[model samples]
Target: MSALEERNRRVLVIDDNVEIHRYLREILEGGAEDAEFDAMDAALFGTGAGPIAMRFDVTSVYRGEDGIEAARRAREEGAPFSLAFVDVRMPAGIDGVETLERIWGEDPEMQAVICTAHAEVSWNRILARLGAPQRFLVLKKPFDAVEVRQMACALTEKWLQEANLRQGEARTRAMLIAVPDAMLRVSTEGRCEDLRAVGAPQLELDDMLPGQAAVAAREAVASVLAGGPTEVFEVEREDLGRLYEARVARAGEGDALLLLRDVTDRRRAELAAAQRQLHEETIAAQAEMMLALSTPLLPIHEDVVVMPLVGALDSRRVEKVREVLIQGVADRGVSIAILDMTGVPSLDAELVDEIVATARAIRLLGAESVLTGLGSGVARTLVEQGADLGGIRIHRDLGAGVAYALRARGGRAARS
Candidate 1:
């Protein structure tokens, strides 16, 4: 077992006289050797009448310095002495009071008994040096063996209880450090009782919950104390420019526990994501409107539609043009789609490809595509780029395209 586990019954006796040391040892440890006498006593007077079996591990030291050294060593080894018996006068060394002071300085939990035959130092002087009468007992040189044993047992038990209490407080402090939220224990009247901070240490819980926040927390805590549900509220810190969520719950005895979590970062991320989505949607709607305006589809004649293209056709606008033409032709059920590019200033290979692709898409939907308003500059560029029209009908202007559509419709009517 560890030293601490076995330290409960340990005791120390400090005296220069060998006979005194021998007497204390016999009194403290002699009980175990008196088993035979105990049995006779038990047989004479029933088993209940026998002395209680008690044993203690006692260490004997010769001088005041030796006693202090032993106590310091025991403390460093984590098995400190529960009690010490020191003689008041030690020849050529310090006395009982000095020895006890030095030992207590190292191990404050150790209880001591000052042994003296004559009054070498006044009791008031000892008390003045020690500063407390709680841990020390004065015993005359002719001390009672039973009284010594009783003191040993009682003081050791007190030391163990104090050790246990210290351990419990240490564990509680560790648990508080492990929690991530800032916590405060508040009464129903909104008084802050206790505060603990784990992650958000800058939050001063000692400061009364501020302004409207104080009123909100007080109401919430009062409701909880009255058997209401736990309440949560959001409060913004204007100084820090952040947000926190406070959760208030009943902690019994008219007190409530307030747990605060900083949610500023999460809220900011959500807001930024929403703003980004809104911007993208707004741009998309504006682009759709511009596409419709740029490619205006007008039904100028029966069975024929005219699309007047007006902007320089970048790749994006080219895709827009293709979408408008394909959708317009299918929806209107027009037989001929006349694309009037009179306002288009120039042409490139990529633009020629886009125009051809639009015509192909319209033809697939069972509509014939007609090209008109081709200026000489654009016509020459198309020829130079080796652009292929693939049998798509062409006209010089909108009027010719419409006349062709009417004639074609009339011919089909006659045939039918």
Candidate 2:
């Protein structure tokens, strides 16, 4: 414990009788080592370690007005009493109820006990005058020494607990003020009261946000204040060229806290990346379409169709060629399907086998397959790969292939 926290327990006594004050001082201060008092402390506070031995610094005032003045001075001097014992009837000045009221005005945290001898003092009236039971208790004037000690210990401990809690809250608020994000404390109705900002000093609530963003901010605040969960929303200010993310949460009764941070660079980087990704996807799609269009199937005669294959023939491209040739022959009932591979740059042994297989598929559809425009290297590769070309005819070029098909079909002329 700190030196200040370990200081003597401060108590105030307000009564017209001087004997009552002396008796209380003796009971509180002189009963430190009494076994009965130690037992009472253990029973109340659950401390089994012998006597607490707390010292008392008691202040006594005969009149209620003087008690009030003393209480006020104690508070101003940074030595406020933790508890006060007040007698109900003080004939020289304001009564106990009025004196406690004035003392509370000075130090609202001060715990009080109203002492009265008569049974007909109207506790209901006293309760009505003072607000609630958490801060004050009533004591019969012929004081039980044990009860007095118990009240003094319990009420003083309660006051200390409350003081620690308040200090924690103050420190928390001080830390919040140093945060980089702009913060606002607003009422349920969206009235901004306290604003703390490290960077954006001019940043404010809904007024600073534009269009639907302002409306969204107010709605978020209302939702948090209505006991809903915390809300997160984002808004962009084109005028400032900045985007901000805001979070709203309940602070106290009927109050909401709003915190905002600038996310402009992050938002712009995301948009730029998205645009780049979309552009790359669009170019890839166009390339695929162009590749499909590059290999075109043309029908020159009634029963003859020619496809000029181009590009480096991978497995995927060769499979596409097979699909187009077989489907076209089935649809047109062509007797001769010629595959002219003049534009193909290169081929492997596996690709050569794939080409032979394509020709076989066309023959199965009741059409004669003609292979043309094979360079010396591709033809050499076909021989080296040991490809089966049993049902297909090979021609040197497209013209020779077309001429041979026409002659087999009774020498038909070219279409106009």
Candidate 3:
């Protein structure tokens, strides 16, 4: 940009001197490609500001009364003046300072430059009346054209910067309020500058209050301010039908943020998973037990395994029982083999023949068979069916049968 364009020119000239008005407008508005102009003569005093150019706008007035009136009318029309050149020595209707006050009331951002040559009009007097005089500029009557243009251009840029700053602040505040979570602003000095709770519920923090004002529910804030590692703390409350657990955490330096979600569902899911694990273990144990019982087993101890035989003996059971007795006797190295028929219901002729063959089979294998679950009725039926048991020994119960077998073997030993 050129020196003129960088100034961003928009000039409002208010003076009683017709030549002065023309001079101020000419010097302030000329040589700008994007500036607006409303050049006015003394006769055009009370006309309001011109229409706002899309880029910039400027207006001029003749008298102080006319300037104040035009300022009011420009404000009503929503086209604010940016830079005003006010003459100090005006007629008694109003002076430059009073007009300056009214101009600010209409548009607070308008920058004014007091144009004067009077020694009696002190600097403090005009400044004190115009509120914060540093915001304005003052040029003497004998100033050159370049000096007037410089002052006007500087004030115009100053107004634009001020307007930009105010708009930026307004936008920032709007964004801050739109956040969904609670936000806190603190300094490193442990001073809380601001706190805004967006979705947090109102709590009875009378007892937990910090300072004198509820301690502000700010553990997370305190953690951040102390330069500690960020941490999460759970606070449970039964406020809902079920329990609700709140997880609070520190977010960043000088700031703490909070997000809340219900975790009752997650807890229940964990519990259900544990129960399913236990049920699976139980099923595995039951399967192991069935496997142990259904399959045959080797004898585990040096003791007898008394397997009593009952109902009609099938050939499959006869073979299984024979295998159990022979293996048990051989493994334990025991002396007696007693076949006590105490509960046999109705032995098949062929099955009885198989049982005797099994006992003989046990003898050959260095062990013996003992069948103890037969009754007298089964014995008689076995004899009537012509089942063969001539060479095998039998007994009603284990005691008498073992005694007879012992004596008979002893007699054979004595004879030998």
Q: RMSDs, each prediction?
A: 8.2, 9.2, 15.0
Per-candidate TM-score against the hidden true structure: 0.63, 0.59, 0.46
Cα lDDT computed for each candidate against the true fold: 0.81, 0.84, 0.61
After TM-score superposition, what is the CA distance of residue 61 in candidate 1 from its true location, in Å? 5.4
Q: Write the per-residue lDDT of candidate 2 for residues 1-416, one digit (tens) a residue.
A: 74434743799999999999999998777654566777887988788555465556889999999999999999999999999999999899799999999899999999998999989887798888998778999999799988898888888888888898888877876787777676787776656755543334333456666879868888888888778899999877788888899898999888888788888888889999999999999998987787677667899888789999876788877887888899899999899999998888678989998999999999899999999999877888988888888979999999899899988888674433
Question: Model 1, 1-416: lDDT tens per residue?
Answer: 54434557778899999999888888877655677777888889997774454667899999899999999999999888888988988995998888898998888988888888987577888889888798888888687889877777777777778888888877886787677677788776666654554343333333656688877887888899999999999988898898999999999887889888889999999999999999999999998888778878887655678888875878888887888888888888888888887778788888888888899889999999888888887788889888788868888876677678778777553344
Q: Show the colliding residue pairs in model 2.
A: none
Residues 1-416, model 3: lDDT tens digits: 44435443556778877888766655654545324233342225433434322222456777787887777776678666778888898775688888888878777778888989898888888767776876788888876987876776577778878888888877776676675433444433334333443344444333222343323346555665576555454444444434333333455655554443446677789889999999999998886564434323333223323444445556666666666667666777744556555556677667777777867776676554555545666777677877666556666675555455446456442344
Which scores higher on TM-score, 2 or 3? 2
Candidate 3: segments with Cα more than 4 A from true spot: 1-8, 31-58, 181-416
Mark the 10 consecutive residues where model 2 has the least summed lDDT: 196-205
> For model 2, how many clashes?
0
Better of 1 and 3 by lDDT: 1
Decoy 2 TM-score against native = 0.59
